[model samples]
Target: MIRVTAALSRARAGLMLALQAGLAAGLAWFVAHDLFGRPMPFFAPIAAVIALGSSVGQRLRRTTELVIGVAAGIGLGDGIILLIGAGPVQIGVIVLLAVLLATAAGGGAALIVQSASSAVLVATLTSTTGQPWTRFLDAIVGGGIALVVMTVLLPLNPLTVVRRAADPALRAFTGGLHDAARGLADADAGEVRAAVERLRAAEGTFAAFSAAIDAARENVAFAPARWRARGALAQYVDGAAQLTYALRNVRVLLRRAETALNDREPIPGVLPVSVRHLGDAVELLRQEWDRGVEPLAARERALRAVAESGRAYREGVGYSGGVVVAQTRTAVADLLRATGVEYAEATRRVRQAIGWTARPHKARRRSGRPGSMPS
Candidate 1:
């Protein structure tokens, strides 16, 4: 059932992209063939398709690269054919020159590949008598049409794209946090280990989130229709790095938890409860963000988690258990920061929750050792 749902979701996204690509290709062909009067303008549609790449974030860059690559390849091929004549040997030489030149120009993989492929096509397909810039102009028209199709005609909803990408990653992280909490409650090392593995496996989901943010930001920046989403996207941009930190901190918390269980450390009841509270906080934050509301409840939950972790520590814990408590406090701090709290304020809140109050004289002391200063 899950596989079927995933396939359907993928197909829907694919259909949308295909529609855009098809529209861009058709428009490019019409412009090149009718306006430019270039009979059989095959390169036009080809360039359009290449520019409208599958990766949402790369369309603009790919379009620019495609135009430049086409120009370079066509010019090099034409110049080489005029000197050496078109043949098997000429094709190889043209490809080599195109690849080398693109590489020297610090072009990406797409640019280099496009350059070589265009050179090969020009060398084998077109006559030397054709104008050198004819296909280059066709490439420009195709790429231009693709950009217009992507940014102006069929711009994706920035908020929708971001939500789709973020939900899966956030859900996976929340699930992992819950699993770790369960492991702590039950004193099951195996469960904690499994949760660790689950989080590690979610790297791809996090990568997708990053890419989605990039695409959404680009849409907000360029697509006038998507400009309204900029305010919503600001939360995502502000929280992205902090969210990553929070996930990492949770992973560390789980590992410490597993270690504490394996070593037969006495687990405090508040430990598992605190972790569960943090998981709840994360879910609440997501829900509130979707509803376009302040994450006040989520922040309160996270602060409570930190306070409970401190109480757990004050109740007396073994070395590994102490580390677990410490990690819980830090993780909640990261969550607080993810809610757009400034770093210093978040740190102060976490410290206050953890029952740490720095004395002014302690700050003046030159102490480099860990925990050397009074709090």
Candidate 2:
């Protein structure tokens, strides 16, 4: 059932992309063939499809690369074939030269691949290697049509894209925290190890969120209709790094928790409770983000987690347990920052909640980096 629902959602998203690609290809063919009267303008539709296939983000840059690569490869192949004549050796030399030149120009994967592919097509397919600027012009028309279709005609909703990408990441983060809590409460090292593995597997989800943010930014920038999403997107922009850090810190916390359980360290009940509270805060933050509301509840819950972690610390823990407390403090600060709090303010709030008030004569121990683990 879950797999079916996910498939349906993906199909819905892909439908828009398919429609955009079809419209761009058709328009490019019409412009290149009917208007420009170019004979058999197959390169036009091919360029359009290739540009769109690059990625959902960076449409303009990808289109530009596609057109330039096609033009350069075609020009190079034609000039070389005119000089050396078309044969296996000539085709190999032209493709090699095109690839080297594209690489030297610092072109991306699409540009480099398209350059070699275009050179091969020109060397093998064309009988007479005269000036083939018509193919280059066809490429330009195709790329321009792709840009228009992606940005102006069929831009995705920025908010929808962001939320859809964020859902899996946030769920994984929250679920990992809950699993860690359960492991700590049960004093089960194996369960906490399982949680660590789950968190590690979420790297792909994190990458997806990063890509979605870039795509959403592009949508809001080029599509005037998506301008209203700019305000909502600001939170995601601010929180992205902090959320990544929080996820990392929680993984570290769970690892230390597993160590503590394995070593028979004193695991306080409040420790697991605090972890559960952190998980609750994460879920609340996602809910608030989807509803476009202020995440006051999440902040409150994170602060409470900090207070509980402090209580657990004072309950007299062993070395690994103490490490867990320190990590919890750092994770709480990161969660606060993820809720749009400023750095200094979030640090101060976390310190206050964890009973770390400064004293004139007493020196406090410095906290280590958030996600670093002891060897």
Candidate 3:
């Protein structure tokens, strides 16, 4: 069922890409040929299609690279074909020259491939038209229109893109947090191990989240249409990274929990409540991420959860139990950072939320090191 859903999602995304590429190409061709009276102007649509690309993110950089590649191809192809005339040898030479020149010019894979392709067209077709600058003009027309269309015609919502990737990841993380809480409550060794495995499984979700944010960053980087949301989108990207860190901490906490459960150590009652509250907090965080609005009520709830757990800590249990609470505190603190809180403040807030009445936590609380967590 999951596979089917994933397949359908991919298909939908593919359709969107195809539609956008078709629109951009057709528009480029029309403007270059019909509007400008350029002879056929085939390169224009080709440039537009290449610039549009198929990926969901970073159209700006891709468009820029494509434009550079097309320009290089047209210039190299026109000059070489004009000097040497069209032939198999001239074709090969122009392509080689275009690729080498593009490479030396610091072009990436897309630029290199585009350069070679454009060189071939210029070498073979430009001579037929008897106008060297026509295709160069065609290339310019295609690239500019592609950028304009990509930027404004069907502009992507950065927040929507972030949510499409972040929601699943956040849910997975929330589930992991819930499982870890349940394991602590029941002191079930098997359940703790299972939760750990589930957390590991969530890595893919976070990876997709990271990729989506990167795309959003590119989309918002320069386009005036997307610039207004740039700050919010950037926050989402940073928040995703912080969530990754929180998940990592959750994994560590769960492993410690599993060991504690296996060893017949005490499990605090408040720990489960705290963990469950944090689970809810993650959901709220999702909401906050989606809206790009943060009063950080989610972080507040998470901090409160830590405070509740600290209540259990005040009474004292075993060393393992203390470590568990400490880990939970730190994990919640990590999550709070995702809410746009500073690390120092987040740590202070987590400690305050836990309502730890005791003195400062010593280095020997869990692992015997100075402020560094055990890996």
Candidate that would win on TM-score: 2
1-375 per-residue lDDT for model 1 (tens digits): 999999999999777678888999999999999988998778888777877764465435655787678767876887889888999999999999999999999988888988898889888988887666777778778878888888889877778788888888888888888998998899999999999999998778888888888878787788998888899888887787788888888888888889989999888899998988998999888887787677899899999998887777557667777777767777887888889898888878877777676645456256333222322
**Full ranking by TM-score:** 2, 1, 3
Clashing residue pairs in candidate 2 are none
Instruction: Rate residue 260 of model 3 by lDDT.
Output: 74
Model 2: number of backbone collisions: 0
Q: After superposition, how far is residue 60 of candidate 1 from its true place, in Å?
A: 3.6
TM-score of each: 0.86, 0.87, 0.74
Question: Against the unseen true structure, what C-alpha lDDT does each candidate score?
Answer: 0.81, 0.82, 0.77
**CA deviation > 4 Å runs, candidate 1:** 1-8, 78-82, 124-129, 355-375
Model 1 weakest 10-residue run by lDDT: 366-375
TM-score result, candidate 2? 0.87
lDDT of 3 by residue, 1-375 (tens): 999999998887667567777888889989988899876888899888777773456546666888878877997888787777789999999888888998898878888998899888777665644676678788888888877776777667777777888889989888988987887888788987898899899999899889888777777764567888877776687777788888987787778778877888777788778888888899888887677688377988888777776776556456666666767777787788888889888876765664433444563365452222421
Instruction: Tell me how candidate 1 scores on lDDT.
Output: 0.81
